[model samples]
Target: MARSYEANLETSDELAAVNEMLSAIGESPVNTIEGDSNADVANCRRILNAVNTEVQSMGWTFNIEEDAILTPDVFSKLIIWLPDYLSVKAPSGTTVYVNRGGYLYDRNAKTDEFTQPVTVSLIRLKGFEEMPTQFRTYIIAKAARRFNIRFFGAAEIEASLQLEEQDAWARVQEFELEYGAFNMLDGDAWVAGRLTR
Candidate 1:
C-alpha cells in the first residue's frame, strides 16, 4: 500500500506580489494583467522587473542546472549562453573553469577534437511563484519604496518606505547567512590561509 498525506503549501504569484506592493502603497489590488489600463498596474510590472533584477544582482541561493556543449576549437573555449544566465555556481567536474565573461576554460588543455557536454549549475532569478515568503516581502517593500519615490514624491512616505526596505534587506541578509547562501570568503581569504600555514 502507498502512503498518502495532505500538505498545506503557501504559494505566491506575480500578481500577488504586485498586489502586496499596491496594498502597501494604499492602492487597490488588481485581478489580472489583461485589459488593465491602470497606471498602477504598469508601474507594478516595472517595479517587479526591477526587483527581479536587483535580487539577481545580489546572487541568492536559488539556482538552475543546465548543460552546454563545448565547441571544440583551437582556443579550447566554450561559448555558453544559457537563458538568463547570471553566474556559474560550479561546473560538473574540476577540469573546467568559468571565466570572467561566463565562458568555459578547459584546464586539461584538450585539443580541438574534444567535444562533450559540460554540466553547469548557475544562480538565477526565481520566478514569483518560486520565491520564498521572505523574498516576496522584500520585493514588495523595495518595489513600494521605488514606486513612492517616483510618483508620490512624499518625503514622509518615502522615509517610511525606506525604513521598510532596510528592514526587509536585513531579513534577507539573515536568511542568507542562516542558509549558507552568503559568501563569507574572498580571494584575500585564500592568501591569508596560505600565510597562516
Candidate 2:
C-alpha cells in the first residue's frame, strides 16, 4: 500500500528520514492479548503481541502527533531537510521545503476570545501521492516527537473510504486524536499513540 512518488519532491530526505525513523520504532513485533483489569504480566504481553498485529495490519504507517511538536525549533530540522517540490512556511513566514502534509499553526490562539486565527494549514506537497507506513519508523519518527500521538479513532475514520485522506482535513473527517487520551510517561507522552506503526 505504499504510495510511489517523484524522486525529487521537496523534503524527500526529511520525509524519508521521518519515514525511516518511524520504521525503526516499532519493527519488532511482540505478541500479547487484552484482558480484564486483573490481567497480569502475561496479559500485558498479550496486549503487546496484539499491538504487533495491529502494526502489521497497518503496513507500518504512522501519524506524528503533537499537532506539531511543542518546540518550534524541532521542526526546523524538517524544514532544512525537505526537498524542493515542497516547502514549509511557518505562520511567522519561516519557510522550508516539504512534499507531503504538514500542519503549522499557533497554539496560543486556540481559545474562544482569541483574536488571531487559532488554526493551522495542513499543507500537502504532492497530490495525495505518498504517505509513510513503516511501523517502527512511523512510531519513532512520528509518534515520539509529538506532544501526544493517538490511534485513529472511530470519529477520525470514515468507513466509506477505508483510509484517511493524504491531507488531514479529509482524513480528520474520519478519525480524531484527543489530548486527554494520552498517557504521561517519564514526563513525556506514551498514549494517544497508534500501533499502526
Candidate 3:
C-alpha cells in the first residue's frame, strides 16, 4: 500500500517510534497503536517504553528538576509520594533521601515520614512526546535496533544498526554537554578534595 507523508508527519509520538521499529524489521508501518493490535505492534510498543525509561533514568538536563519542593501527605503527614522520581537528592541538608516504594524514604531519619516540606533535586521520567527532538531521535534509533534484533537476529543488520545507535548516542551526549553545563567543581568529589587539602 502507498503511504501518505501527511499520515506520518507527526513523528514525536509513540506511534511514530513503533512505526519506525516496524520499518526497521521490514514490516509495514502501522497507523495507530492501541491495546487491540497485532503482536508485533504490542511488542514494539513495550520495547519502546522500556528503552525510553532506561534512557530517561540517566538523568539528563531535560528530565532533571532542581530545588523542587515536596510536601508531605495532608492526612498522614508522612510518606511523600514521588512515583516518577528516578533519582533524588536533598540538595543541602543533613537528611539523606532515597526513593523507595514510590515514596520518599529518609536514610538519615530511618523513616519515610516527613513533618515539613523538603527541597530536593530529582530526575523524573518524561513521555516520548515531552522529550526534545534530539532525545526522541536517539530513543527511536535505539528502540529500532533492539526491535530488529528481537525478531530477526540478523548479524549484519544488527551490526549496522548498532553503529546508528552509537551515532545517535554521541549526538545526545554532545547535546547533554552543551546544555548540561557540567563542571568538576560542582560535584562532591571536588568538595571532598578541597576538604582534604
Candidate 4:
C-alpha cells in the first residue's frame, strides 16, 4: 500500500494552541454560581446548551451540560466544568465541572474554548542528531513502513574539505549526504533507515 499519511506542519500550530488552552483552563476558575441551587442548575443547563450549539458547529456531539458540576465563583470570568472523560467528582461543598478533551463555556467570561481533532506523524533520524526530534521520528516511521529500506549508518559529513563558517549542511548537497555501511559497527546507527510493519 502506498503511504498516504503525510506529516502536516499546519497541525503542529493547532496542537500547540490546544495545549495552551488546556493550560489556561487548568489555571483559570471553572465555574461560579449565584442564587439558589435551582438557578445554578439552570446556569449549567444553559452553558451546556450553548456548548451543544458550538460543538455541533465543529461536527462533534457532547453532553457537557448533563455532566458538569457547579462551583462558586472563585475567580471572575470562570466556571469549571469537567468533561465526562475524566472520572472526577465534585469537591466538598462545591460543584464539579467536566468537559473532557473538549471545549467549555463561561457565560460570565464570554468565552468558549474547545478541543479539536488533531493528528501527526513522528519521525526519527540517525546520524544527523541535529534533526528535529519530531521530524526525525516521522521520517523514520515513514521509512520503515513505506520504503522497506534497510541500510547502514548515515553520516552527514561534508565531502568538500572546506573551512565552513556559520553552519554545516546549509545547502543540501548530493554527495554530502552519506549513508553508513550495513553492519558497519553496531546494530544501530543507520544513516537513513526507516522500518515498516
Best by TM-score: 3
TM-score of 1: 0.66
What is the per-residue lDDT of model 3 for residues 117-150, given as tens digits with 9 covering 90 to 100?
Answer: 8888787877666778888889888988988888
lDDT on C-alpha atoms for all candidate structures: 0.63, 0.29, 0.77, 0.27
Q: Candidate 1: lDDT over CA atoms?
A: 0.63
Best by lDDT: 3
Clash counts for the predictions, in order = 0, 43, 0, 31
Taking every candidate in turn, the Cα RMSD to the unseen true structure, in Å, is 8.3, 19.7, 6.4, 25.0
Tens digits of per-residue lDDT for model 2, 1-197: 64322322223333343332233333322232223243232332233333333333332113222223222334342221222122233433333323333433323432122123222222323311144333323322222222112322233223321222124233332332332243454334334243223
Which portions of model 3 show Cα errors greater than 4 Å?
1-12, 92-102
Query: Pairing residues by index, what is the TM-score of model 3?
Result: 0.83
| Candidate 1 backbone overlaps, count | 0
Off by over 4 Å in 1: 1-12, 64-80, 89-114, 119-121, 181-188
How displaced is residue 61 in candidate 1, in Å? 1.9
Candidates arranged by TM-score, highest first = 3, 1, 2, 4
Cα shift from native, residue 72, model 2 (Å): 11
**lDDT-based ranking:** 3, 1, 2, 4
lDDT of 4 by residue, 5-105 (tens): 11222233323322322222232222322332543233323332332233222211121122334333443433333232222223221322234334344
C-alpha TM-score for every candidate = 0.66, 0.16, 0.83, 0.14
